[model samples]
Target: MNIVKVDVFQARLPLIEPFIISYVRLDDMPTIFTRIELDNGIVGWGEAVPDQNVTGETWHSTYDVIVHELAPLLIGKSPFQIDAIHQQWDAQILGSPSAKAALDIALYDAMGKCANLPLYELLGGRAHDTLMVPRVISIKTPQEMAEDAKRYVAEGYKHIKIKVGTDAKADIARICQVRDAIGEDAYLRVDANQGWSRTEALQVIEATQHCAVEWYEQPVKAHDYRTMRHIRESVSSAIMIDEGVQSMHDLTEVIREEAADMLNIKLMKAGGIYRALGLASLAESANMPCQVGSMVESAIATMAGAHLSMSRTIIETNEMVGPLMFTQDVAGVPFDGEQLLLTKAPGLGIEVDETYVSSITVQRACIE
Candidate 1:
């Protein structure tokens, strides 16, 4: 099938509430949603991580890159040759994984539609259709955090991931409050977002030993692999690396140095499904556990992650709750229940309602 045009929509959706963390806080999501329409009248959709602070991608930059840089590279290329397109695009952009990810996902969706197969099926099929995605409560006051955990449990979520990287004492108290509130039956995990000092991480992890944390992710900064290894050695709690293991280079270092017991894989950081799969393969070879994470995404990107998570062998946890957390989503099918489910339609197995889309789109570009 011949590729026709690439459409970039800059959209802003309100978060259910302002999501706070040590690094950044977001009340409104400013993102670029990409839709690739083929000449055969098939359309595939994807989302770019427009977190300017995290990836240096903003709505304007995403639109410019896709329309002026990426779209031209793929307009006439065979949609099924995913790798070839990536190789060409990689040569052009030195480090725009977030932008590249948007195009890559759209192209994959187009390929799946051309083949009349579900996206997961083309991605080596799926091992499990349903996965337990834990509910994440942003770090807050101990009392408020405990109430958040209780609310998640009341909503039927069996697991919770609390954001930390604030004061060690408050972080520990937050975890304790959550555990006590949710009771012993729910799984508990923490993401420090590389906000702690080595000493701080150590003290916090040691203090929370009573909380029975399933794992503590990126306790210290991303570059401090030495500290990561040290923390892994010093603590009884499992250590997972998030920002630390964003690329194959990072994955190599983490595995070679034995820096972590687990890793967090996010589509935005890993570039796309293919690169994500590569990271998973490396983790598999090293026998390391992985958790599929999100960078506040819509159902399109989250479902893309779910497809990858299912086909992989190492993912032990899931955090694809962006749709649930965001007040609005651009995707047609939002995640349902505690599991992130994909629709039965071909390709991404979802539809985009133009009405919802037009309501949220901050900008739009058409390449005719």
Candidate 2:
């Protein structure tokens, strides 16, 4: 079907509470939500949550590029030609994955609706129907963080992701405290968010070995493959690359170096669903397990990751707890504790609440 209209809405959604990582603190998430309508009267939804540290984009930049630069390219184009449109975007634009991701997701939604198929069906049938999601405990005091971990575990969560890397000794204390609180059974994944030096990464990972961490993610800087390899070799826990591997090229480099045991594939970082599948393929060939994560996104991007996570068995973990942390969710889907049930509904399966969208939107633009 021919595409006709591109509507971009810029919204800042508040977190239920402040979210602090190694690099920055966020009280609210700035996002670009997209709606693409075809001449056949089908409408598709997409979203872009630009993390300045990860995607190298701001919400304002993502919105501008999508509405001004990318929307023109979508006008009159077939929504089903996903791959060709990506190639076109690459030829015309340089590096704005966040901007392109919004459009890419929107295009895929339209394609799925047009074909009357669920997203995972289009990606090849799903490997698993239910995903065990991990709740995140942001950087906080060791006691506070441990209590948070206990709260999640009490709520029947089997997986917990503890954010660290702001301080090495404090991080060690945080992990140890959480491990003690959650006991040895619940899965704990530590994400440093590239917050330490090579030496510090080694020290923190080593000191927390007794905690039985499922994985240590992005301990050092994104470019430090040598150190990552060293830590991977040194640690008893698995070492994962989140900020380290953004593209297939980055994945290739990490593979060449044998740096990481796992990869975190975010739709925003990998560009979108199509390219994320490409990343999953490369990771599969390399025998690297992947975790489908989010940049604290809404239900739109979160479900996109969930659908993709189901498409591949290699994706061992789901850390896409973005909508869970939001003060309000426009998706109108019920999320029980830690267990994410996938729907077979066409497209992303969750309809966006434009009424709720109108409340949070700070800016809006429409392209025809």
Candidate 3:
């Protein structure tokens, strides 16, 4: 089907609680979403969550690029010619991976709906019916963090990821605190967001070697492959590459160099399921494990990631907790339980809660 119209909407959902990391503290949540309609009246939805911390994109720029530039480019292209359209967009739009990602997913959604198939099936097919998605426990006081870990454990979550990269002593205390509170039943993971130095990463990993961490994600900066390799050798924890590997080419170099044990693929960071799936295949062929990540996106983004996670063959863990972190969710999908369940609805199968979404809109676009 040929593209008939593209629409953009900006929404700001309040966080249930403020999320603090070493680099930034997020209070108000923002999401830029797109809806693409074809000539025959099929519609599909997608979301863009620009990470200034990771990809250096902001809300306003993302929305503008989609509504003014990217949408116009897609107006007459065939929705099924996904790669050709994406490459054409990339040739024109500079450094707007997040904006491009929104359109990429929208095309996938549109095609999937038109064909009456799930996006995963359209991409390749399901590796498994479900994946173990990690639930994040935000940074807080030692006791408070431990209490938060306990709550997730009580909810039947077996894997818990803790946010660190602040003070060395406080971070050590936080890991110990959560371990003590949970009593070693839950699997623990850590995300430093590249806030630690090589020496600091070494020290932190050494200190927590006894805590049985499942993996350590983005310990040093993404650029410091040498330090990442050193830290991986210094500790027994599985080193997961998050911000470290941005594109398929980046992932290729890391794999060739043997930089780390695993990789974290966020659909937005990797661009979309199209590119994300390609990278996942590369990792799988290399026999390296990968996980689907989230960037404070609503259920729309998480569900998109979930489809990839389920359909991909080599994914082990998931950090898709965007809905759990937000005070209100503008989209609906099942993530409150231990396992993230697939929606029975057609295509991606979740409906965007437009009423709640409209209440938080900072901008809106119409399909002309």
In model 3, where do residues sit more than 4 Å from their true spots?
Answer: none
Q: What C-alpha RMSD separates each model from the true structure?
A: 1.5, 1.0, 1.5
User: Over the stretch 1-368, how does candidate 3's per-residue lDDT look in tens digits?
Assistant: 88888888887778888888878888877788888888999887889998887887888888888888788888878778888887888788766778888888888888878888877777667778666776787778888999999888887888888999988788888888888777777889988888788888888888988888888889888867878888887777899888877788889888877888999998778877788878888998899999899887888788888887878678877777887787678776686576788754556767777677778888899655
In order, the Cα lDDT scores of the candidates are 0.82, 0.89, 0.82
Better by TM-score, candidate 3 or 2? 2
Q: Which candidate tops lDDT? A: 2
Question: Residue 282 in model 2: shift from native, Å?
Answer: 0.4
Question: Which 10-residue window in model 1 sums to the lowest lDDT?
Answer: 327-336
Candidate 2: clashing pairs of residues = none
TM-score of each: 0.96, 0.98, 0.96
Over 1-368, each residue of candidate 1 has an lDDT whose tens digit, in order, gives: 77778888878877888888878888777777888888888888888876565566766777788878887887876778788888898888876777888877887888878888888788777767578888888878989999999998999988899998988889988989999999999999988998899999999999889898999989987878999999999988899998876689989998888999988988888788878888988898989988789887887888788777776658867788888877667665545668777655677777777789888887888876
For residue 200, give model 3's deviation from the true position in Å: 1.0
- Cα TM-score of candidate 1: 0.96
